[model samples]
Target: MLLEIAIGDAYGAGFEFCGREKIMRSNTLESYVPHELGIQAGCYTDDTQMSIAVAEVLLANSDYSSDAFADAYVRCYKRDQRQGYAKGLQGLLDLCVNGADLRQRISPESRRNGAAMRSVPLGLIADKNVLAQAASEQAMVTHNTAEGILSSHVVALMSHALLYDKAKLVELPDFILEITGFILRGDWAAEVECDALQTLHAVNTALQANRCMSTLLLDCVNFGGDVDSVAAIAMGLASLTPEYVVDIPASLVNGLEAGKFGSSYLRKLDVALAGRYPVLSAHLVRQS
Candidate 1:
């Protein structure tokens, strides 16, 4: 899931906010493109970095808490400050001393897509009820809004459905309605930047699809604003869509940055996460 998040983030990194007209002209998905951060071809942005933070917290034997999530996010952000975090958040990351300070300082209730973007790790928990509580806790660490929490819940639950019971995904609009008591209406326009509702709709649409990772990712970028995040959040769960690398382009994986927290790290995290859970549908995945 983390690996797929990085791939999708990196895949859409090149075209973030370029809008529909500019991205369509490229007409190709064969290789990594230049990222807005001016990083190397396949180096991911804050999406994968913060996701690694969430994964590490889950990897820990200690209990999950907002302090822990905040600390992990701060550590990851400090490790790579120039990785294209949002301007408003970049300032917050600098002043806050630790996790405790972050929670207090992040007073402005943001409904941005960050909550949903880093939420891929929450789906690893098999129990749906427990997962929902944890998802709210993690999202409230920064994005403490009704919309923010709801979007996180939707992505985590949908990811769980994709992994455990894909058929339940068809019931997403209903499941969200049933669980959150929130009605999901249609008529969402594209160009989804940091908006929680729009991104949730996009992730749900991507998960509702059983498309190959290649097509899923390309289609995500075509959705326009904040394309990288939509792709990252969608691909993290859908990465386990049973297609594996056979359906995924080799270049997307091989071409990822080989830094300390790059593709190799993501692969190890996936292996460790799967070891801690029952991956019923992924028995055929390539270990290598």
Candidate 2:
């Protein structure tokens, strides 16, 4: 799931700011291409970096800790500040590193998709109930808005469903709708345009068309705003099946920048995670 998140983010990195028409002009997103970051073709953005941080902290502590997660996020940011983080996240990290309490210093107005982008790790590591709590905790570290927190929850739930309910893959659209509807009836009902709802609607529409994995990814990217995060979430959900996992091109995996966490980190994390969870081990073995 983590590897799929990174691969999807990197694959959509080049099209982050491009409109659907612009992407259409390019024909197909067969491989990596340079984007505004001016980095290598398959270099991931802050999405994958923060995700790895979350996974590392969870593995080390064996549970969720907002402070530890915040510290890890700050560490990752300092390691590579140019990973296309939103202005709000950069400011939050700055305050955190300077001794401010992240929970109190967070900007509640920041409803960006960053929270959702790094949430796959939480979903993979926790059970259904714990997943929601951890997703909320980690997301509120920077994005304190209800919409932001809920967006991460939706992604976490989708990831959990993908991992444990592989047989019911076709029911994902209905599940997403039910979840989003419940969210809208809550205290954050005013946040109708939240990223979670938008992404769910997009996914539901795409699934209704019964498109292939490549087309689904490309459509997510071509949706334009917050493309990388949306594509990453879409990719994580799509990767539940062996077919979609194999559909991910080798070039994107090969092109990712080998930073502190080298290319092998994905395989290493997979082994470690599977070892820790027998259910995950079964899922991975079947996928393999």
Candidate 3:
């Protein structure tokens, strides 16, 4: 799922903020597109980086507390902080040294998709109940709003349910709403913005409308604003589905940026997480 997020993030980086008409015209599926931010093709952004931070916290600490979440995110952000973070977040990342600093300075009302994007790995925890709590906590460290927190929970829980065969694709949106009580309605054809609800709706819409991972991701990017975030969420979830898993092309799997915390590192982390989670052992599709 983390690997899939990076693929979608890198794939959509180029067309982010480009209107639906333009994106539909280009329809740059099956490969990475060149980003205006000058990010190299197949290189992911802050979306995947912060997700790695959350995954790192989970891997290192059994507690998954707020402090560990904050520290891991700060450490990950500081390593190489140039992967398309929003300007306001860039400033916050600059000032925060640790969990204490993060607690003192982090905004409580910010409702962005950052939390949802990073909440992917929370689904790997064996205990679904514990996973739900960790999911909310992980989002609270960054985006601390009802929508922000619930959006993360939805993403994380959806991942868990799908991975464990607790839910099916057709019933996913209803199941999420039933559990989280966060109803988000939107047109996938419309512009998807930075708002947590809108982004989640767009991603959900795209996921339900398309079975092919490539088409689902295309639906996400075509929505325009915050394209990478929507695509990242959509593709991450789609990768878990048996039908969609094979639809992802090899170019994305092989073409992602390589180095520390890059393609190879994500694969290693996936293996390590699967070793502990066991549930993930049979579905290690990052190498597939």
What lDDT does each candidate get?
A: 0.76, 0.65, 0.79
Report clash pairs, candidate 1: none
- Give the better candidate number (2 or 3) by lDDT: 3
Candidate 2 residue lDDT tens string, 102-164 = 556765566667677788767675466777778877887777788778878877776676676
Q: Which stretches of candidate 3 lie over 4 Å from their true place?
A: 19-22, 184-187
Q: What tens digits encode model 1's per-residue C-alpha lDDT throughout 214-241?
A: 7878778877888889889878866655
Error of 1 at 256 (Å): 1.0
Pairing residues by index, what is the TM-score of model 2? Answer: 0.82
Cα RMSD (angstroms) for every candidate in the order listed:
2.5, 4.4, 2.0
Sort every candidate by lDDT, greatest first.
Answer: 3, 1, 2
lDDT of 3 by residue, 97-154 (tens): 7777877886757788888888878888767788888877788887778888888888
lDDT of 3: 0.79
Preferred candidate (lDDT higher): 1 or 3: 3
